[model samples]
Target: MHLNNDHLISLAETFKLLGDPTRLAILVACLEQEKTVGQIVSDTGASQSLVSHHLRLLRGARLIQPRRDGRHIYYHAHDQHIRCTLQDMIEHIQEEER
Candidate 1:
């Protein structure tokens, strides 16, 4: 596909975001289901403070999205594009191992 300069820049920024292990873990935790901050912490063993911080960056990057149910907020993989991209990348690596 043809990507303009802005598109390329944004793509690079997205890669930079995914380069973080913590943030990547958080995203993996939300891949299949929506999770609250506490659930994410439980899944990844990251502190609430740390999870919250990463969530902000992930949200800003549009890699994940937040939903509110009353006082609690749930986060999930942003959309099919992100979800599929992540899943596909994982598969790519797994394929190499085989």
Candidate 2:
């Protein structure tokens, strides 16, 4: 498939967003289930503010989806595409560790 300039730019931006460890951790935290910001903070051992900041960026990138239930917001991977991509990456890292 031929990627035009716009497609290349969009892909680059998405990679840039994913390049952040905090953001990647946030996404990984939601791989199996949706999580609140506090849950992500606990899982990632990151500050609430930092997780929230990355959440906003991930949401903007459409890598995650957020739903509001009362005062709490739950976030999860936006689609199977993200889940599969993350899964593949995890496997790659595990392979490297061997």
Candidate 3:
């Protein structure tokens, strides 16, 4: 896929968002199950406000999506693409460790 300047810039932005450890933890926490802000905080050991902030940024990037139920919002990866991409990247790193 040929990425133009605009596309490259957007891709860079997405990587920047994913570069933060806290944000990565938040995403990993919600990978297998949709999690509320409280659950994310517990899983990531980040403050609730911090988790919310990262959640907003991730939602904006479309890397994570939200579903509302009553007064609670559940966050999770929108589809298999992110999961598969992460799994592939993990394997790549593991192979490098050999």
Best by lDDT: 1
lDDT of each: 0.97, 0.95, 0.90
Model 3 residue 96 CA deviation (Å) reads 4.7
Ranking by lDDT: 1, 2, 3
lDDT minimum window of 10 residues, candidate 3: 82-91
Evaluation by TM-score, superior candidate among 2 and 3: 2
Report residue 84 deviation for candidate 3 (angstroms). 1.2
RMSD of each: 0.9, 0.9, 1.4
Provide the global lDDT of candidate 1 against the true structure.
Answer: 0.97
Residue 59 error for model 2, in Å? Answer: 0.5
Candidate 1 — number of clashing residue pairs?
Answer: 0
* Per-model TM values vs. the true structure: 0.95, 0.95, 0.90
RMSD (CA, Å), candidate 1 to true, equals: 0.9
